[model samples]
Target: MPPKLPPHTADALFFCPSCSTWRRSFTNTNTTNLLRRAHQRRRPASTLAASSHPSPASPTVNGARNVPERFRELYAALQGVRDVAANHVNMSRLQLALRGLEGEKGIVRVAVLGLDNTATTARLVRLLLADPLSEKAEWEDYLQTYRMESSRGLLIRYGEQTNLAVGNSLVPTISIPSRALKTGNLEILVSSLGARSISADQTIASDALLVPTIAIQSTSTGAHSFVRYPVHKSMVCGKGVNGLLAYTGLVGRVNPNTADSIRAAFELNVGEGATPEGNDGISFVDIERAETALDMFRESVQNATEYEKGWTGSGVQPLVDWISSPAKDVAIDPAIKRLVDSTLDGAEKSIVSEEKRKVLALEANTVPEEVRMALHETVSAWAERAHTELRDSLDQGFASKPWRTLAWWKLFWHVDDVGMITSRILRRKWLPEAEKEVVWMGGKIHQAGLLNQETNSTNPIQNSTEFEISEEKSSTFSRNLWPTQIPDTRKQLTTSSVPSLHRFAQNLVMFSLSTTSLSSALSALVYVSTSTTSVYEAGTIATIGLFYSLRRQQKQWDAARGFWEREVREEGRQALKETENVLRSVIHEGGRGIETAPETEARQQIDRARQALSNVK
Candidate 1:
């Protein structure tokens, strides 16, 4: 500035003393302006416009974009989660409903109880439902399908068989496919054969009173009087009089006198005032009359040319009319509806209560703990018993003269009595005892309701013929004492390689001792015959060698005895241990199959499901 120098020269000469401060200020301002211009030039026009007009929805460097589209996406995700939760709730309710209805297919179960003679009952059931036009083959097939044996009761459902014998009781439930049952209607039929009272057949008849049903007493005309008893309200009102059917089969003849006797018996047993609430009482039908009338009707229909002329009058028209009167569609009786509703409610409440109990049980580890401890105790007791048996067998083997014999000749050729005894005890006594215990345990588990259908179908010990012993790492014997094959009493004892090796070693020791003794005797004879000092010294040396050989043989014998005892003990112990482990595993797996989740989680889920079901109901 002093000499008015060119601008470039002034800027470059900022070190000049006179206007130095001013030059410095000018240089800093000029540098900042140039940087600002370059930054402005680098920025896009859109960025500049956005910065000038700054919308609230625009994205910022440090914050998310406050856009409506993002909000919409978040709301959609929340709605989806809500929908999924609702669907899960709905599905749970549906499952509960289906279970209450018995199954998804809604199968109707009709229990047929009473009657001590199953064959007569079967024949009666066939008479009730059998078609008149059915062929002989069909009747035979039906009889076979519904055949009830003393060992097992049969369940006939749509011509399929299911054995209902749980243990000793027969729970014969006959299933009929009907849409009416899907609407919560149930029918039970109780039948009494001959003059036998229903109360006499307490096994199935007493159980039938719990369900809603109708009683049908099939009596012979020869019976003088009928027995009368109080009937349960659940059974009587379940289907009303329309459902009850009493059949009097013709024993001798189907005359007026027989009908009068049947009528008198019906009046004595199930009179008009016999029902609880004065409802039209039980209907009685003469089987012989009905059968004859049905046959005539069938014949008339078969030979019909015109309906007006084909109509025939049957003497049992009143009975037929009474039976057919209830066939028309009628609303369920209020009492019956209330009964069904109450039953359903009771069942649901029971299910919920049972689930709650199960949750508590799971939390307390009650079932698993009880089953595990019981099974463990059983296995332990069995093991202890087996150990005692093994010890006894060992003692017996040792007490036997053959096992303790040190005779060189016998030792060289004789079988290992100890090993053979051990094998025999393991094969016969121990294995059979184990199988028996296993079978008993399985039965107990089944009785305790711990076993399911799949597990209970076959015996648990059916395939457990072979027992293996694990080799001990610390055993001094070179051979392992484990069985390589299933125990067979028929097989030769030499099949066991370990026992054979032990016998060979024992024979070798005896052989050594025998050779040493013979050598010593020959040396003494030679020394006496020669009469030399060197020969006498050689005989003395041979005598000393013989003594040492005898001592070595004694030591080997003791060692062999110890080894055999130890091996047998170890094998027995290992066998017991393995058996216990197997039992424990079986029990654990069975318990685990029925194991529930954690208490809190299960309770919460059950509560939610129950709430959903209640809401739907």
Candidate 2:
């Protein structure tokens, strides 16, 4: 029986199922475990210490030794930009620029972009400073990052609206319409109908919580700074009308295609193989750990046998047969034999039919057909090599050498481990998830151009029985964030006004409900039925009595006059509201500060940071 394989190596192999799977690797070779561990004659500890540190001549920053050539170049480019002062002015300048460039395709104006942008930005800065690797580096890292994504924007609503109420201000609003998304103003109407001399009907709805992501293009083409925030709803209502208003918004899921487009742009600006952008504050030790892991992985792949790797489907069985043939002469331990058999069995199981095998062959087109067909031979050769090496080492007849004899199992374990580690390292190396959150230069703006298109214009006219007036076609929006619906303009609003009589003699109605007038009129008609003179006499007396009765009720008329005054006051109130439409706003009057910090202070910090970085090691 072959003695147990090295426990460390054995455990590593089974621990990583990905190593055997190699789901995203370029090759599917199973020869990684083919090598016998290099025999180490004793090496002095002093030599290991000498290799631990880098020479002075080597380029590095903040103690990151043996820096990649690419990073050196990147570091140079980063240092070259004289942007401290300009960058400091950038925050204020950008806010103005964004507001001024309204109506541009894909342009967005965030009075305040999102709820979480500033908080997240501050946290990110702290993280960058905490990274020990950049301990001695200049403040450039912090300042640049702070500007890059710091969203100190105030608050705003998503979509569009006609009115925003801020304190005593009533902002006039314009309609913003899309299919499933529609913005409505809080409609309030004053009335004086019957007992209600000054009544108000208000219909207010809760603001739909929305998350806003803003990607601002920088001076460089395609380069962008992106920020996101949750929207806070602020509107006046019943008890809350006089209180503070706040809205809730959620971060939207990025569309799949949009994510891909964004990733391409980020890679364009950030360079390939750099650590993901979000992890800018990690220590050099962590970076070194990653680099070491990568080196180990590359070496494992490099050590595999070339022949074992190229098994096209046609050659797989032959390789399998050859590998197991070692069972004939080597007298493998029953346990080891079963281990080999089961792993092989799994491979066969993965390709149950010929069709699947051919598909795999086509995918690995670089491997030659001859090598593919010789898979069986390759596996058998591996077994034979392990046996021969072990037998020869044993013949040396010094102390026993079990390593060469156990090389085959070690090879299996290594192969499995490399796959799992490779997947992890590769994913970290080519991170694509962060792309969705950032916008890059030259990124697609088709989805962001919604503001450039017009949506259905809904005019809320009073006294209308329908909900919509007319359907007007608008531009299409991305389905990921907005749903499309057929435009229907038949909608309308209904008004509740009291019936009135026209004042013109020809148009006015002579009808009156006064009891004395009605009684007099009926008596006159009966008197006229008997004689014209009697009817005339009775009509004159009835007219005089009617006038007297009206005169006696002057106190009642005075009371009714109060109701008319109320109706007039309601009209004036409505007119004033219309006049204040331009000044209405959603937030308190004091919430509109564009830049929270003084310009001088920001610029001073920028310069100070630049100077500090200049002095960094």
Candidate 3:
């Protein structure tokens, strides 16, 4: 159970720095500290590269360490939560930790796609069997198994005569009487070309593709393991499938200097054709292409395991070696390049007209309406479909998937592709001058230098030695601790003395005001108070007389007070000048200085004075 405070005292308050909104917080102490640290760092939860604008001084990312003890404890605490809540907690921490890792420099963005292996498939089966969330308890009865080799169509048909649609084409209707037996299967039709040779886009005359009947169903042992393979089909450029050439092409594009040497070596091998003398006899492009493909394959495998198995185990080199089975000299394998080219082609088709429209609209916003309207016209038929239909189809296809599972990855990809393009255009056309303005403002603030006076001065503000004065008040408070021993008379005398002193000070000020001559005011008080009687005399006669005489000589006291006040005021002005000078030196030289405790001292002094005055008699 959570802690319970009284209703009146349990009120919660919260705020967000981004929206600058105030609200109630159910967050606890740990949550509060996390927010405070984030504020100090001045970065979003999932940070990107530091903004081009000036960033707040943030702590440098710390090197990775062993798992934290706090996380271990948190993991243990999660056991108490309900199943759904436990999952939520785990997911929350997973995302937070992933964000932290991503924010680090040199960390590449990676998508881990896991293909089901035999061992992993078995584990998945066991988990499914044990799943408390499942409605069916009889596992064997609920499970259905399917063989991959079976010709059973994964399609099912519902009510007949419905209009079937695919990509702007409406097929002619066919009548299916309800009396003609259950779930009709189409007879196998032979074609001159094999199924594998058929293009994916070719239209087949039937509604068979509309319903998928066969699917890999959950079994007691688990679903069958799917083969791990690249989605891209390798396209060999030359006679053989040489990955070296592909790698070289990639390397050449990225690093021409290194590619030159590789190319020279390849030519040298070609010249010494017979047994290739001292050469490996592999083309430079072939060698590099093989290496690149191997590298990509290796990365993909590692990512697959990590994503599917949720494994954080170390020693990845073995997995890499196993995945990247590079063969010797072969033909030009254009697998990677082909994949990239196809993707780029698709993007270009969809993005060209849209990009044009964006640029035009942006320009229109800046130009006169008459000029903007002059440019308006119908886009080509291809351009309209290219810009619209493809986009709509792609969006619909993406929406049909289990998108929630891959939402974060998709969001990250979106940021990389679209956000980066947007930023580049904005910086090129709009932000250069704006950035200069910000820099100018920063320079002026640096130059106008104001110093924090409290950060300097030789004497400590609290005056640790001022304990004697504060101690007196403590003594007075303690004197009344044992009220029975002390007379109440002392308290009465002490209480009256404060008002009397104030009255005396007021009277002296009035007397000084009445007499225009300072000498008359001082002489009258000095003579009367000192010459009066032995009531003013004591063993500490000189000190006692000095105190009383100074008290009575209002005119001299006033003159000295005014003189010292003016002198201190001038000293303060000088101190400020000195402070500003020091600040300028620190700013230029990057010298460090300690903060002065003036405010702390002032507060302490005020407390002490109030206490002392309360006890004054």
lDDT-best of 1 and 3: 1
TM-score winner, 1 or 2: 1
- Sorting all predicted structures by lDDT, with the top scorer first, yields 1, 3, 2
In model 3, the Cα lDDT at residue 572 comes to 29
- The TM-score-based order of candidates, best leading, equals 1, 3, 2
Model 2 earns a TM-score of 0.17
Tell me, what's the RMSD of every candidate?
A: 34.1, 46.5, 36.1
TM-score, per-candidate, Cα-based: 0.33, 0.17, 0.18
For residues 1-617, write the lDDT of model 2, one tens digit per residue. Answer: 11333444333322111010111111334433222111011111111222244442332332333333323332222222213223312222222221111111111211211122232322222221222222222232332233223221221122233222211101111111111111111111100001111123321111111123333232224343333321111111111111111110011222221111111001011222332322211111122222233334344655223312221211222211211222233322222222222222222232243335555543343233343234324333433443443334323321223222212223323323322332232223211222121122002222222122332123232343322222221111222221111011001000111111011111111222254677687767768676656766777767776665544433333333244334423432332232122111110111111222233433344344334333323
Predictions in order: lDDT: 0.37, 0.25, 0.26
lDDT of predicted model 3: 0.26
lDDT of 1 by residue, 114-225 (tens): 2334443444333334344532334334543454432223333332222232221112333443222224332323333322342322333221222312221112121121
Q: Which ten residues in a row have the lowest lDDT in candidate 1?
A: 15-24
What is residue 610's positional error in candidate 1, in angstroms? 20
Of the candidates shown, which would achieve the greatest TM-score relative to the real structure? Answer: 1
Overlapping backbone residue pairs in candidate 3 total: 27
